[model samples]
Target: TPVNHTFGISGGKQFKVGADNNPLSFFIVGSHGTNYSYTGELIRNTTSDGTIYQDQQGDKYSQNINQLVLGNINFGINKAHNLAYNFMMVHANNQYVGQYSGKHTESHQDSNDYTGRAIRQQTNDNLLFTHQLISSWKLSNKMKLNAGASYNRIKGLEPDRRENYLSKQDDGTYILTGSNRQKRFFSELKENDINTKVNLQYKLNDEFDNTNSALEIGYNGRFVDDKFEAVEYNFDALSGTFPIDNLQLDDLYNQANYESGKYTMSVGELNTYNVKKNVHSAYAEATYQLTSPLTANVGLRVDNVDMTVNHRVQHVEPGRESIKKTYFLPSLNLKYDLNDKNAIRMGLSKTYTLPQSKEISPYQYVNIGFASQGNPNLKPSDNYNADLKWDYYLSPSELFTVTGFFKHIVNPIGRVDQGNSAGLLSYSNISAFATVAGIEVELRKNLINRVNTATSKVNRVSLGLNASYIYTDLEVDIVNTPRR
Candidate 1:
C-alpha cells in the first residue's frame, strides 16, 4: 500500500450581464499553494559495486508546490458572431530527496560507512494567452457558413538542480563519500511559442429535395513559431561538512569551483538548438442519404508541413536541417439502421503523425546511474485505419456496443539503451511498418430506471463496463529487437 498527503485551496468568480438582448460574461479563477510531502519506499534486492554501482533499497519523499491563474471574457457581438479571450498562467516547484544504504567501503574511496543521499529540485513557469473570434452566417435557407480565427502566445522556463555525494580514489575505485563530498549539476531552459490559425467551413443541404443530404467544405491555415534556449552547468566537486537544509544555492555557486571557467557556458553535452514548424491544410466532404435507413459520407484532406532545425554538431560546427512533406488523406464512413433499436457503423481513414519538439531535439537528461537522450533525425509516421461498430439500444437509458478496429502504421518510434558513459537511453525510429488489431465491448445502463420507479427525468444511478483485447505485429528495421 502507498500513502498520499496533499492539501490545496482554490477560488473563482464569474460576471455576466445582458446588453441590448445580447449576453456578455467575464470570469477569473485562481489557485495557489501546494499539495505536497509524498513519501514512498523503494525495494531493491540486488547490490553492485564499481563506477556503475547503485544502492537498491531507499526511502524517497517529494514535495510539490504550484499556482494557477486563469481569466476569460466572452460576449456575443451579434446573433451570428461571437468573440472570446482567455489567459492562463502556471508556476510550479518540485523537490525530492532519497536515502539509500549500502556497503560504503566497497563503492566510496573513504573507509567510513555512510548512507547515500540524492537530492533533486526543479521549477517551471508557464504562461498562455489566446484570443478567438467566431462567426456563423445563414447564407441561404439550405446553406450555412461557420468561420473562426485564433491567436495564441505561450512562454515557459524550467530550471533543474541535481546533486549527489560520491568519492574518487587514486586507485580508480569510487565509493559513497556521503554529504561531505558533493557533485552538482544545473540546467536552465527558456521557450517561447506563437501560433495563429484561421478556419472556414461552409455547408450546403437539401440537395435534390433530400433534406438529409449535405455537402461541407473547409479550409484551414496555420503559422507557428517556437524558440528554445538551454544552458547547463557543472559545479566542481567540493569537500566539506555542511547542513543541506539551509544551504543557499546562489552562495554555493559563487563560492564553489566551476568546471567550465568562472561563468557557465554551452558546450559539448550542453549544446543548444532551435526548431520551427508550419502546417497548412484543407478538406472537403459530402454526405448523401441513399435511403431512409442508410447514409454515406466521403471526404478528402490535404496537408503541407515544413520543419526547420538549427544547431551545433559534435565538431562545434553550425548545422542546419529542414524537412518539407505533404500528405493526401481520404476517409469514408457508412451508417445503416438494422431496425428501430439497432445500428451499424463502418469507417476507413488515412492519418499522419508528427514528432514533438523534445522528441526531435538532441538534448540529454542525466541522473544517477542512468541517462536519457533525444534524436534529431526522426521522421513523421503514416497510418491507415479501419473500424466497424455495432450498437444495440436495449432501452431508453441502456445500450450495448461492440467494435473492431485495425491499423497499419509506418515508422514507429521506440527507445533503445546505449552502454555509453556506463548506460544511456535514446529514442529512434525502430520499425518500418506495423499492424495492429483490437476488439472492444461496452455496456451502459441506468440503474435507477431498472431498479426503482422514478418520475424524475434524471437518473440517480448509472453503470458502465468495457473491455478490449489487442494484437500487434511490427517489422524491425533499425535495431536487433524491440526494447519492450
Candidate 2:
C-alpha cells in the first residue's frame, strides 16, 4: 500500500515607512514544502528463549521530502531601532528496496529460508540561518540603554549513502557478495554562532514616583564554531561474475562496473572534527520594594569559557583538546502579596552545563542496530537550583498554580552502556553526584465567558490540566565498574 502526498505554500507582506508619530515598518514571510511516502513493513527478531532471532523483513520503504521556509522579516528603523531575519531548509530522501524475505534463524542450525536482496539509500541536507540587531536608547532622565547582535548558522549533510547486498541465483540473476559488498557513506556537519549584548538601566526613584528601586547591568558574548566529517566506502569483488539484472533502480552502478573488474574500493577511517567556543558574561541586578507586600530580586554573575578541540581519527590517534572555565554565579528572587487573589514565589539559582560539539567529539557513529561515541574526556556540568511558588487568581480569567523544585548536580553527564563498546553508546561523566526533585500542579478554567447563551448547546471552551512528579538520583563513577 503506497500513497501519501503533501504540498504547501504561504506568503505575507507589509510595508509602511516613516510618519505616524515615529514609525517605519516592513515585514515579509514565505514558505514552501513537499513530501511523499510509500512504506510496507514487517520485520521481526525475537529471542529470549522464544527462539527465532532475526526472523524477517517485508521492509519496503520510500520517502522524499523538501522543505524551505526562509521566513521572518522585521522592521522599524525609527522609534528605537530593529532588524531580524531567519531561514531554514531541509531535503531528505530514504530508500530501502525489496526481497529480504524471512527466516535465517540465528544463522541456521536449520530454520533457514533467507535468499536476500537489499538496497539502501539515505540522504539528508539541513540548514538554518538567523540574524538580529537591536537598539534602544534614551540614556537620560533616569537612564536607559540596550544593545544586541546575533548570528547563527547550521548545516548537515549525508551524501553518497548507498548499500547493496544480493544473492538469489539459479538463473533468475543476482549475485554480489564478498559476503556483503557495496557500501558508501559520507557525512558532514557545520555550525556557527555569534552573539553580543549590552544593557544598562537605572531608575531609583520617580520614573512616575518611586514605586521601587531599580538597577540592571549586563554584557554577554558568545562565539562558536563546530565541524564534523565522516567517510565510508567499500565494494568487494575485485574479479568478475558480479551479475545483477532486472531488480531495477538502475540494476548496477555504472561506468560499466568501474571499468570491468566489477568491484574493488575501500576507504573507511576519516571521522574528523573541529570545535571552538567562547563565552563571556557579566551581570548585575537589583530591584527592591522589600516592604509593602514585599518584593526583591538580587543577582550576580560572571563567566568565561574557552573551548577548543581538533580531532582526527584518520589512521588513528590525535584527539586534540582544551578547556578553560571560570564561573561565579548567583541569583535570587522573592515576592509576596498574599492579597489580590494570593501570590508568593521564591527562586534561587546557579548553573553550568557545557559539552556539546557532539558531546566533545571523539566521533563514532556506526549503524545497523547500534554504535555511538564521543567523549574526549568530556566534562562540565554543575547546576544548583531551587524554586517554590503559589498563585491564585480565579477571576481575571482563571488561574491556580503550585510549584516546588530542587536540583543539585555536579559533573553529571549521562548516557551509558559502553563497558568498552560492545554495542556501544557513550557519553560520560558517569556521575559524581546528581539529584532532582519536583512537584507541579496547575488548573486553569474559563469554560466560556461569551455573554449571551441560551443552550442550543453553546460551545466555547477553555480548560487545561497539568501534572508532574519527578525524582532522580545517580552516583556511578566508573572504574572497575560492575553494576549493570
Candidate 3:
C-alpha cells in the first residue's frame, strides 16, 4: 500500500488602446503581468515485503511586461500623391523561480533525503519604421513599387544556483536537503534589415485579362552578445543514533559509523562564460497564379553564420577561447495547387548548429561530487533535410494533412563518460550520426452548430481532438564500442 500528497497556485493580468484621424491613424499600448506557483508531494509505502517512503516539493514565480507604440501620417499635394510613414516600438520581460526536495527509506531501516532551487529571467525590445509612396506609372503597362527597412534590438538575462544535501542512518533511514539560486544572465542583440520590391500588371484583352507578378529581395544582418554566470554549492551530512534492541553494542557502533559520514564530503563551485554570434542572411521569393485552381510558388534563401566564444573561470585555471568556422546555408521551397481542395509541397535545406557557448568554454565546475569541464576544441554540427507534404479538404470546413521528412546529421554531439576524478565522474563529447523517420496524422470536424431559442440563442459549440507520435534511431561508435 502507498500514500501521496500535492499542492499549487498561479495568477496574471494585461491592458491596450487605438485611435484614428481623417487621413491618418495611430495606436499605442502597454501591459504588465506576473504569475507564481508552488508544488509539493509526499509518498509512503508499507507492506509485507518491506517499508519504503519518499517526498518532494518545489515553487516558482514569473513576471512579464509588454509595450507597443506606433502612428501613421499622410500628406501630399492635391491629394493626388500621398506620402505615408509610420514608426513602432515593442518590449517585454520575464522571470522565474523554483525549488525541489526528495527522500527515500528502505525496509532495512536505511533512509536518505535530497533537496534543490532555481531562478531565471529575460527581456526584449524592438523598433520598426515604414514608408509608402503611392503612384501609378504607365510604361508598357501600369506598375507600382513599395520599399521599407527596419531595425530591432533585444536584451535578455538568466542566472542559476543549486545546492544538494543527503544523509543516511544505520537503521536503513536517510535525510536529504538541497538549495538552488539563479541569477539573470544578460544578453544584448541588434538587427538591421533593408528590403525593396516592385509589382507590375498589364491588361492583355478586352475581357480584362490581367497578369501580375512581383519580385522582392531583402538582407537581414544581426549581432548578438551574451554573458552568463552561475554559482552552486552542495553539502551532505548524516547521523546514526538509532538503538537496535536485537543488536549487540559493538555491532551497533560499527553500523553507526557506516551509516553516518556517508555524505560528509561537501563540494562547491562557481562558473562564468561569455559568447557572441554574428549572423547575416539574404532571401528572395516569388509566386504566380497560372490559372484559377492551379497556382505555383517558389522561394530561395541563403544564410551566413559566424560565432565566437570566451570563458572565464573561478577557483580554477583561466578559461580558454574557441572560434567557430563560418557556415553557409541554402534552401529551396516548391508548392503546387492540384485543385481548390488539395495541394502538394516539397522542400530541401541545409542547416548548422554552433556549439553551445558553455560547451566550448574551458571553465570547470563541480556537482554531486563530480567535476564537469568544457572542451574548447569542439566543432559545430551540420545537417541536411528534405521533406514532402500533402493537404486534402474532406469538406469545406474539414481538412487533413500529412508530411514525411528525412534528416541527416554530421558530427552529431553527445556526452560520454570520461572516467572518475577525485571520487567524481567526468564526461566529454562523443561525435556520431543519427537518422530519424516519423509520420503525422490529423483530423477535424464540426460536430455541432449554435441553437437559437425563443428567449436566447445558445453559444456556438464545437469539439476537436488531435495527437502525434515520433521515433528516432541513432548509430554511434565510441572507444571501439558500437552503440545503437
Candidate 4:
C-alpha cells in the first residue's frame, strides 16, 4: 500500500503603450500560465489477501507575447551621419495532460485491471528585422577612421503533439482477459536566417603612443533554411475466453460459420516521416598589437552541410547529402608586468564542433517502450586548449588568483543497444578520451555600517559571500559502456 500526489502554481502579466515624435518608440508585453495535478493508490484485504486500486492525473497550460518598435535617425549632414532601426515580435504556447488507473481483487475473483493515458502540445513563433549605419573620417598626422554596416532578418515556427494509452484486465465481470495499446503523434517545423556585417578601425599616434599601434578587421556571414514534418498512428486489440466454461461455446460458434470467412484477426498501423536541412557559414577575424605586452590573433572559417530524407515504408528509401569544411585558427596572448602589484598571463586555442541534425538523420521513431533510430554516419568534433594565469594585489580592495587548464578531445558520440526485447536503438561514433582539472575561489568583505531607525537613515545594510567547485575524470575503452 503506497500513495503520493502534488500540485501548486499561479501566474500573471500585462502591459500597454503608445507614444511618438518621429524618433520612434512603441511597446507591448503579455504573459499567462497555469498548472494542476492529482495522484492516488488504495488497497484493502483483511484476512484473505486481495483488493487493490490505483490512480494518477496531471494538467498544464501556458501563454506568452512581446512586441516592439525602436528608433534613431538622421540621414547626413555631420555628427557622423547616423541611422538605426529595430522591429520585433514573438509568441509561445504549451499544454499537457495525463492519467492512469488500476484494480485487483482475489477470492471474490477479479484479479487485475489497468489503464493509462497521456497528451502533450506545444507552439512557438518569432519575427525580427534590423538595420544600422554610421561613418566618420579624418586623416592627417594623428590620423583617424571609423566605419560600420549591419542588417538582419529572421523567422521561426514549431509545432508538436502526442497521445498514448494502455489497458489490461482479468476476472469477475471485468471480462477481457488482457491486451490493448494506442499511439498518436504529429510535428511541424520551419526556420529562416540571413545576416551581414562590416567594420574597420585605424589610429596612428596622438599622444596615445606606446610606440603607436591600432588596426582591426572583421567580416561575418550566415544563411540557414530548414523544414520538417512528421505523423504516426497505431492501435492494437486482443480478446480471450476458452475451456473452463464453454456452454458448447454458443452452438460451436454458429456451426463453424463462414459467410466471408476470415478468422483470428488483429491489425492497425499508420506511419510517415520527412526531413530537410541546409546550412552555410563564413567568418574572418584579425587583430594586432606588437607592443605594450605583445598580442596577436587570426581566424578563418568556411562550412556547408546539407541533408534530406523521406519515408512512408515500402523497403523505405530516399536520401541526399552534402558536406564541405575548412578552418584555420591562430591565437596568442602574453602579458608581463612584474611590478606595481605583480602579473603574468598566457593563452593558446583551436576549436571545432558539428554533428547533430538528429545525429545525422536517417529517421525512425516510436517512443516509451522503445524504438528510436537515427545515424547517417556522423562525424566532426575537435578541440585543443591551453592556459596559464597568476595575479596578486594585496591592498586596494584585496585580491589573489591562480589558473591552469589543458584539454584535447576528438570524435566522440554514443548511443547503442540493438538486440531488442521489443525495444531497439542505435547511433555510434566513439574512440573516447577525457581529462579535466579545475580550481577557482573568491572572497569579498564589507559588513555593517549605518544603523539608526526611527524614521529612515538605515541605508540598506550589507554582507557578502561566494563559493565555487568543479571536478572531472573520465576514461573509456569500449565494451558495453555507460557513464555521464
Candidate 5:
C-alpha cells in the first residue's frame, strides 16, 4: 500500500576488519526515497460582528531523500576495553508549489471589495550529519567507566523562492500594479552541536541484584553554534508584451526581461543572525535499598550555561544579547513493592527549559496573511515537578499503570497577539507563574500466549496504549496599540 505514495530502495552490509586477534566489526547502510503529498487548507478572516471577511490558502509538497549510516565496534584482544564509532548523513531536496487566490469584502462605508491571485514556488535543500565515538573499560572488580563524544551539524538553504501577485480591475482583467507584487526570498541556516560525557559507576557490595547498592558520577559538556541569513527582493514589471491566459511563470521571469528593460528588482529586507551556547554540568547519584520491599535513588546536579546572540537587519536597530545562568537540580525517586504483582512509585525533581536559537533572535518574517517576530530578551523557565504512580502486573506479558503529576513553572515563554493587528504576532513572557496538572493511564497486552518464564522474551504480537488528561492555568496583561 505504501508503494502508491512512496518509492524507495535500501541496502546494508556487515564486515570485519583488522587483525583476527582484535577483530573490528563494521556495518554500513544506505537508503533512497521519494514522496509526494498534498494537503487541503481553508483560511478565513472575519470580524466579530459578522461584518468584514477575507479568505486565502494553498498546500502542495514533494521531496526526495537519501541517507547513509556507517558504524564499527571493536573489542581489545585481552577484553580490557570495548570501543565503537558511528557516522550518519542525510540529504533531502524539497519543494512546495501553491497557487493562492483570495477575496476581501469589508463590511463598512467608504470601503472597497477586491479579489486577487498569487503564484508561490519554494524550493530548498537540507542536509544533516552526525558522528560519535564511545569507549568502555572495567577499572576494577566493582568499578566501571564509560566515555563518549558526539558531534552533529545541519544545513538548510533556499536559493530562490518566488511569490508574485496580481489584482483584478473593473474590466475583469488582472494586472500587477500593487506594492509587493513580485518578490523573491532567499535564506541560509547552519547549526553545529557537540556533546561529551564521562561517567563512572562503583558497586558498594558484592551483590548485583535486589539488595545491590551503587554510586554514579558523571561530567557532561555541550556546545552549539548557529548562523542564519535571509534576503528579500521586490521586482517591478515594465511595459512589455505578456501572456494572461494560462500564464507560465518560468518563461515570464526570463533574464532577458531584465536586459530588455521589462523588469527591475530592488532589495527589500536583509536579516543576519548568529548564536553561541555552551553548557557544562556535573552530577552524582546514589541508589540503595533500605528494606526488602523498598528502594531509593537520589541525585544532585549542577549546570552552568553561557549564551550569546547577535542579529542585524538592513534598516532596523542592530540587536545584541547575552545570558548566563546556573541551576542546582535535585531529584528523588522511591519505589515500594506492595506484593509480587503490584508496586508504587513516587518521583520529585527540579528542572528547567532552555530557549532555542531561533526563539532568542530578534528577527521578523512576513507572509501572505501573518507576520511573526522573536524576542531577544527571553529567559529560561524553571520547573518544579512531582509525580505518583501505581503499576500492576496482570501477567508475564501484561501490564497496567496509572499516574498523577503536577508541575509549577516560573517565567514561562509564550506567543502573544499585539491585538492592534489581526496578523501581527510576537513572543514574550506570559506571566509570573503557571501551573499544570495531569493524570495518565496506560495498558500493555499480549495478543498471543507464548513463554511465561522469568526472563524477557521476544513477543510477536503486543499492543500498547496510553491516554492523559491535563489542566493548565496562566495569566497575562493585554496591551492595546492602534494599527496603522
Candidate 6:
C-alpha cells in the first residue's frame, strides 16, 4: 500500500465559567484539509520484433480539499442536572482522474485486462451539517434519565466526464489520430435525518449479597428523507485532428471545465428518485450478580423500519417501491471469576446488517475499465453469534487472553460480475447460509520496569501480540463464477 500526501491545519478554543461543581463551557474547533496523490503500476518494457518498446503506463490521480467546523456548549443547572449541545459542519471538494491504455485490435485484445488510451474524470462537492442536544437528570439517588435529539443534513454533487482518443497501430502502439471523443455525466443527492432517544438507568441495591446490579431501558425514533437526480449529456463535437499523441491529466482537466463551458453539453438521460425511511426502536437491559463471583447480563431490543422509494421512469408510470421490516434482537453475557487472577466469559447475540444507501440506490457508477450498479431489491443479512473467552491477569500492566467464536449468517451480499462489454460489477445475495468459526489468542508482557532515583531516568518496555485463524463455509451455487 502507498500513502497519499496530505496537508491539514486545525485550531480550537474553549471558554468556561462558574465553579468546578457547576460550570458552563463552550468550545469550537475548525480544520482545513488538502490531499492529492497519483497511483499506478510500475512501467514495463516489451521486446517485439527484436526491438525494445515501452508500454503505455496509466495513472490514477485524485485530490480532495475540505473544511470542517464543530462547536459544543454545556451547562449544569446543579450537580444533578446538565444540558449540552453540539453542532458540526463539513464542506469538501473531491476529484478522481482515471487513465488507461485504449483498446487494441481484436487479434491482440485481452478480455480480462484493459488496453488502450482513455481518460475519465469525476468531481464531486459535498456538504454536511449536524446538530445534537442532550440532557441528563438525576431523578433520584438510584435512578438517572438521559435524553438527546440529533439532526443531520447532507448535500452532494457528482459529475463525471471522459475522453477517448485512439488511432490505428500497426506495431501495437498508439498514434495521434486527432479525433476528439467526449462524454459527460452528472448527479446530485440531498438527504436529511432526525433522531431522538431517551434512556433511564436504575441501580439495584443488593445489600444482602453485597453485589452491584443495574437496569436500563431506552426508546429511540428516527426519520430520514433523501432525493437524487442524475443526467447524462449527449453532444456531437466537430471532427478534428489534434497534434498531441498522448493525453495528460492537465489536458483532460482543461478540456472538461464544465463551469467554463469548454465543451458543449446536452441532456441525454434524466433520472429522478427519492427515498423515505422511518425507524422506531425500544430496548431494555439488565445486569445482576448471580453469586459472589458470578455475574449475568441480558438485553432485548425491537426495531421497526419503514422505507419507500419513488423513481421516475421514462414513457411509463412512476416506479414506487416500499418495504417494512421488523427485528427482535436479544443478547446474553455471563462472567465467572475463578479467582483474583483468572476469569471466564461467555456471550450470545443475534444481529442484523442492513444495506446501505449506495447499495440499494438505482444508480450507476462508471470507471475506466469497469462500472458498478446498485440493486434496489437488496435485503438485510442476519447473524447468530456465540463466543467464549478466558482471561488471565499477570499484573496491572500484563495480561493474556484466548477466545473461540462462531457465527451463522443468512442472506449474505457480495459482488457479482455481469460479464459484459462494459465490465459491469453488481451486488447480489450470493449465499443462502454461511458459517464461520475462529479461535484467537493474545498476550501482553512487560519486559522491563525500572527507575533510577538519582538520575531520574525510567525504562518501561512491553510486547503485545495477537493472532486468529478463521474457517468459513458457504452453501451456495457457484456455477459460471470465478473460483477463489
The lDDT of each candidate is 0.64, 0.71, 0.48, 0.45, 0.78, 0.74
Residue-wise C-alpha lDDT for candidate 4, range 1-484, written one tens digit per residue:
2222223233323222234222322233333333232323232322112233223343344344434444444333233323333333333333333332243222233334443332234445555555555444544333445454545444444433333333333342222222323333555545455554443545434332543344545454444454455555433322343333322322322324322341232333333334444444454444445555544444454445454544343223655544445555555556665676767767777666665555555566544223466666666666666777676665445556666766665665655544333233556555564545565554443344455677656554344444545555555433343433
Estimate the Cα RMSD of every predicted model relative to the unseen true structure. Answer: 6.2, 24.3, 11.3, 27.3, 4.2, 6.2
- The local distance difference test score of model 3 is 0.48
By TM-score, the better pick of 4 and 6 is 6
lDDT per residue for candidate 1 within 1-484, as digits (tens), equals: 4344444444444445555566677777777665446555453211222342444455566666667777777766446566667666666666666644343332224344334444445455555555566556655566667766766666665655545554434453444344323444444444444444443434444434556577777777776666666555544443444454444545544534454344342232446667787888888888887777788999999998898877753323566667689999999999999998999999999998877766676666655444567677888889999999999999877899999999998887766654343244677777788899999999998777533447545545789999999999985544433343
Candidate 1 positional error at 287, Å? 2.0
The residue pairs found clashing in candidate 5 are: none
Write the residue-wise lDDT of candidate 6 on 1-484 in tens digits: 4454444444444445566556777777787777787889333332222222224457788888888888888888768989999999999999877665634322122332334565567788999999999999999988999999999999998866555544534456554323234566778899999999999999886644533588999999999999988877644442333333543535533555645664454665577778888989999999888887788899999999888877763333457767689999999999999999999999999998766666666567655444577667777889999999999999977899999999998988766654433344667666887899999999999899888999888788999999999999985543344434
Q: What is the overall TM-score of model 6 with all chains considered together?
A: 0.79
Candidate 4 ranges with C-alpha deviation above 4 Å? 1-185, 189-231, 235-286, 289-348, 352-382, 385-411, 414-429, 433-484
TM-score of each: 0.76, 0.32, 0.57, 0.26, 0.87, 0.79
Better of 3 and 5 by TM-score: 5
Candidate 5 residue runs with Cα over 4 Å from true position: 1-23, 45-54, 57-61, 64-70, 74-77, 104-112, 206-212, 237-245, 367-369, 420-422, 450-459, 481-484
Candidate 3 positional error at 75, Å: 12
Between candidates 1 and 3, which one is better according to TM-score?
A: 1
Winner on lDDT between 2 and 4 is: 2
Q: Which stretches of candidate 6 lie over 4 Å from their true place?
A: 1-21, 42-57, 102-115, 163-168, 171-181, 207-212, 237-266, 313-318, 394-399, 419-422, 441-467, 478-484
All candidates in order of lDDT, best leading: 5, 6, 2, 1, 3, 4
Candidate 6 residue 114 C-alpha distance from true site, Å: 9.1
Compare the candidates by lDDT and give the number of the best one.
Answer: 5
Scored by Cα lDDT, where does model 4 land? 0.45
Q: Against the true structure, candidate 2 has what lDDT?
A: 0.71
Expressed as tens digits, the lDDT of each residue in 1-484 for candidate 2 is 5555565666666677657444434334444444455566555544323445344465555555555555566665554545555444444444443445444333223335545455566766666667767666765767777787878787888787776666555665556645435688889888888999998888786333444678989999999998888888887743334445445534456557777766557787778899999999999998876566777888999999999989986533887888898899899999888999999899998999988887787777754333567787888998999999899988887898999999998988886655441335679988787899989999989887675456554455789999999999886766445542
How would you order the candidates by TM-score, starting with the best? Answer: 5, 6, 1, 3, 2, 4
Task: State which candidate, 2 or 5, has the greater TM-score.
Answer: 5
Deviating ranges (above 4 Å) for candidate 1: 1-20, 26-33, 37-55, 65-78, 81-83, 86-95, 99-117, 167-212, 240-270, 313-317, 367-369, 395-397, 419-422, 449-459, 477-484
